[model samples]
Target: MGTDWVEEGSPSSSSVVKTKRLMEGLLLQGKNSAIQLQLLLKNSQDGSDGSGSSSEELLGKILGSFAQGLSLLGSCSESASAGHDRRVSPSSGESGESKRRLNLKDRRGPHKRSKASQTWVKVSSTGEDNHAWRKYGQKMILNSKYPRSYFRCTHKYDQGCKAAKQVQRMEDDPQMFQVTYIGVHTCWDIMKTPRMLIADPDTCVDECFPIKQELREDAKSDLTNDNVPSADFFLITGLGSSDQPNGPASVSSERMGFDDANGDHAVPTMYPFGDVANSHGLEIDSLSFDGDFSFDESEFLASDEVIELRN
Candidate 1:
């Protein structure tokens, strides 16, 4: 039975081949449609409307193509599994034994293909996407100066999330990054509530004064004594100070924990209070000094004291 299935004239072999070809065709079609959709979106964003077709129509077509491709892919997987089972099913007689052995051989050398779906997007910053990613690896391409960083979902092991992405800077525009997302997030680890800064006020004082490290000890002492007012203390301890005793210090890509050597740009890591971190884009609400300061939303946003502080 297994031998018959492996034969050129066999229905199973022919069907598998046809299915594989169909899947390839569908994959190509899906890729083309995705590219077209991306172009349309870019055009729309740039305020350049196309003449003939509307974005809604093109979007509908792309969605239909993707849905059809996914259905076909699932069907192909089922067919392959069924064929494998039939080839290895228990049977009687010497021919059956031989067929089982042949099936085992086939299983050892079974055809494999990558079925993971991918999406590519160009963005100004990689960390703008709120999903926590664990950096896995980095590789330098043949003709590229910057190295591409590979990151997987932080909950990959804990929640079985299979989401992964590759981040690489564009050659022409180092400020822009090309991010390629592979696989959908299986883990529903969405952060709904806005993360609040809730740390000891003393510790906040110590961490807040990064500009002058020497002032930290005094700040901590002052915080313990309750000698300095919260607002005045923040202002005095380099919250929005433009002038520095040694030199003017500015937040660079390196300061933000980004790999400047690899052409990575600075991205805001922490958001202000009351702003829920979405999976799509980054938004900030209120500024915090080591999670100790909780000021009014208007005052926080209005003040120039809002600065990215390292934890």
Candidate 2:
């Protein structure tokens, strides 16, 4: 009976070995076919002769190999069960549980962030924004020349602000930076002033900065009447007083071609604060002047405009 049992086990083992060998050969064939298919696709993209027939043939072979492997796997399991009345051994059960755990781990894919909660802006300077950001981390992105810098709101811990941003220099234009902001500011240190109105330089109080008016009404009117987002407002600071002996010259609307009160002249505007539109993704023009002005960093920090929509 022992000899008979040994002979029976030998045939089962031999069949399993043959099945494994066949599976390996099929896997190798499929790998080679996939490599050839990839090369064919590359050649086609490169304007080479890409016959559809060859790719279809390779794909069919790969599918056929997979089908045969599955069929073999089913047949092997059936044969093994029929040949032996074997219970699942303790070691094999443990091994299967370990494999299941590994599969669960592998299936836990990468975490994804919602695009709706994020805002993207392209700017010339990374540090031009008024918000205080603390650099947390930097990462070298794949296929990108420059590293991306991650920043969180400075008031994150103290004030519970959830604002965060990522800054990366553009590969094509190194001078330009891509800034991505996540979440709105909920901190108390935020500027609550209304958006500034860009009137003719002649209407400006100091001749250097544009008129300061409550822009919320105009913004609402633009939305209701024109079905468009309101223009961007900037907080202009650091302009020297006209009383200063060496202060920068006062800008004139006539010189800048904004003298037309009827809005006939097309005043060319510069986006020094970047093309930050309102929260609704509406782009508004920014302020520009003809004369030079010195920017005092302290004054800029003290009187910066907190454009809510710009955030």
Candidate 3:
């Protein structure tokens, strides 16, 4: 999944070039891994020593390295591409490539957003043309290694807030995205409820992070065997206006619990746009999502067809 970071740069990042490099790397590593596994499996098959074969161990190491290399490749082209490697190797014959057919459909499109981009804007809710949105789909991209999810504005019926976001999984870290938000939506309700800003982080966000931790632990096993970080990494953000021209409104803080099966580490709950932007040195009070600024209710209501279609 960490490999998907490069998918953010896929438009300009040549999938052919990167895939070839990765294929060559994986082939070499895979060959070595297979050999090691074969030795270990042969030993196990012989049923000799009480110590079981280490085939699974070798295979796990090989896959982890393969995923890490792909992630590094994707991270290199983060700005130019969506970090998605969509191209299939023409050299791989159909007979042997069927099982490894590079799934390009999961790659990010030209205008899509990736979690790596790290840019988000808060929409104002005071406008009359405010729209609504709903999440439609989410998918995991192969090769580059993260899943991408889709969202569409509900106001498309009449308000036409063609806003969408492409949720790209972090190949190196399943819990993070390469998250690219595409159009600006006037929907006030888009952020009303705290949504799974990203899909299952345990299966996704923590993917690469756990691998890294394991790798680090392996390097330190000679000195210590603790499998957790020494210090916790936590980021806290607060939102609301200090000046009470309208008095202080009781604000409710939403906590998102990201579960990880690996138990490597915990990612703190990320706040919605409501509280997040304010803490990021941005003015949250000035933003609005209302859509009625340009027209009167009578005129808006007169367009019954538009209302009906939107409704």
Best by TM-score: 2
lDDT of 1 at 26: 52
Q: How would you encode candidate 3's per-residue C-alpha lDDT over 1-311 as one tens digit per residue?
A: 22333343434457645654664465356446645655665676687662433644664555454444433332343334422323333443345445344533323234343222222322111111122336689886778776666665565333333345455555665554443444333222223311221121111211222122322343222221111111122111221122221211212221221223333333322322322222223232332211212223454334321211000
Ranking by lDDT: 2, 1, 3
**Local distance difference test, per candidate?**
0.37, 0.39, 0.34
Off by over 4 Å in 1: 1-114, 190-311
Q: What's each prediction's TM-score?
A: 0.28, 0.28, 0.25
**Window of ten residues with lowest summed lDDT in model 1:** 271-280
Model 2, runs deviating above 4 Å: 1-116, 190-311
Q: What's the lDDT for residue 189 in model 1?
A: 25
Per-residue lDDT of model 2, residues 1-311, tens digit only: 10122233434576767875675566456546656766776788899778878876765564345335433443443343242322232332345456667555444444333222323343444434556789989999999999999887776666444557778887987876766665434343323211221111111111112111121113223211110011122221111122221222211111111212333211222211111111112222222122333334454334332222221
Q: Give residue 79's lDDT in candidate 1 (0 to 100).
A: 38
Each model's Cα RMSD: 22.9, 28.5, 25.0
